[model samples]
Target: MFKKFVLATSLAAMALSGAHAAEITFDEAIAGATVFEFDGDGDMVVDVRFGTDDPEGFNTVGPGANQTYISEPGLEGTTLLDTDLFVEFLGGAVGTLSFGFATIDPDTSVNFTVYDDNDNVLGSTTALATFDTGGDFPEALASVSFAGLASYATFDFFGVGSRYIIDNFNGTFGSTEDRTPDAVPVPGALALFAPVAAGLFARRRKAKK
Candidate 1:
């Protein structure tokens, strides 16, 4: 019965988020492919322009850490505008992009703005950055998902200093990725009735007996 209850809740949460997910870890990014405009070399990524500095080059550290992590190169303070990265999908708008995140202080500080093919803002939210304190760089993989069909998304790593990195992007765009939401957040309406549903289930069981 306990297993069944957990399964039901997980399913409910996925149904509520309302977006198909996709992810990528720079590991699969073509080593010499031009994914970023600034990365003239074969670096895993190019800088998206953060506070007058665009750091290019990524590193891998931690347990089984074979993925790439692009860290901000300069010390630009602890504000949201210090670090930025632009992820341009090969195919325009391949669902929402999410990944594991990490930062210097290991705090919840970052923001995101998504755009369509024409560089129009599809949506902006403060919910994109989730801090996952696991790994040598303190990784948090896609604690937040930017929902929609987007050409690309700009992620700003803001916190008490801009020493940030991301890895294990799990979403719809890459191979060896899981589009399935194992434990997505439950939607608002469903969240409200969680306790009520449990109570109702209890009542139904009592009546059945």
Candidate 2:
């Protein structure tokens, strides 16, 4: 009897733990997405060179030759503005996407867009704040609620690129409800276990007698 009680209690505890184990976070949700860092190196040139100087006007020499600056069209000899970094999430479900970025100037406007596998726009939003002249990296967050999106991709700082740093992109799909395996049990499960254990103990006692 005691053993049966202990076993039942253990199973219950395990079930509870398993059911609540899965959690969604900003990073885990969008792991499938790709990340592109512009001027990630200390170079004064942009990754997607357009043949001209950086429009953001950042000229500091850093660890790598890549300089962190915004890209804009009409910059002579510059492909930076035209270059669009993309990421695809193979999972064909709707989820949340998020990332952090700081604009080069306080007054500069920033835009973000999400696209599906077929290159269709899912949703988009613009940052209310203008990133114009301060060096401070202000973090911006954007999200879209979509369903049945074939692929997940994003375009950041669209139109008039700004010196920006982006990271921590994530997407989450799946029920928010707790449905871990251990939490599920057979009907009359606990009651059945108790009786079966008791019957075995009784049979052993009778045999000894």
In model 2, the worst 10-residue window by lDDT is 70-79
Q: Candidate 1 residues 121-168, lDDT tens each?
A: 766555323333333444444444444445666767765545555554
Please give the RMSD of candidate 2 to the true structure: 14.4
| lDDT assessment of candidate 1 | 0.47
- TM-score of every candidate relative to the true structure: 0.46, 0.40
Instruction: List the candidate 1 regions with Cα displacement exceeding 4 Å.
Output: 1-22, 28-56, 63-83, 125-148, 174-209
Per residue, candidate 2 scores C-alpha lDDT tens digits across 1-209 of 99999989986984564322211212212222233223312243222111112333322111121222321110111114533334444333344455444443344334556666677877766663343323233335555555445254544354343544444343432233232222345568988898999999999999999
CA lDDT, every model vs. true structure: 0.47, 0.40
lDDT value, residue 54 of candidate 1:
47
Q: After TM-score superposition, what is the CA distance of residue 75 in candidate 1 from its true location, in Å?
A: 17
Output the lDDT of residue 97, model 2: 50
Give the RMSD in angstroms, all C-alphas superposed, for model 1. 10.4
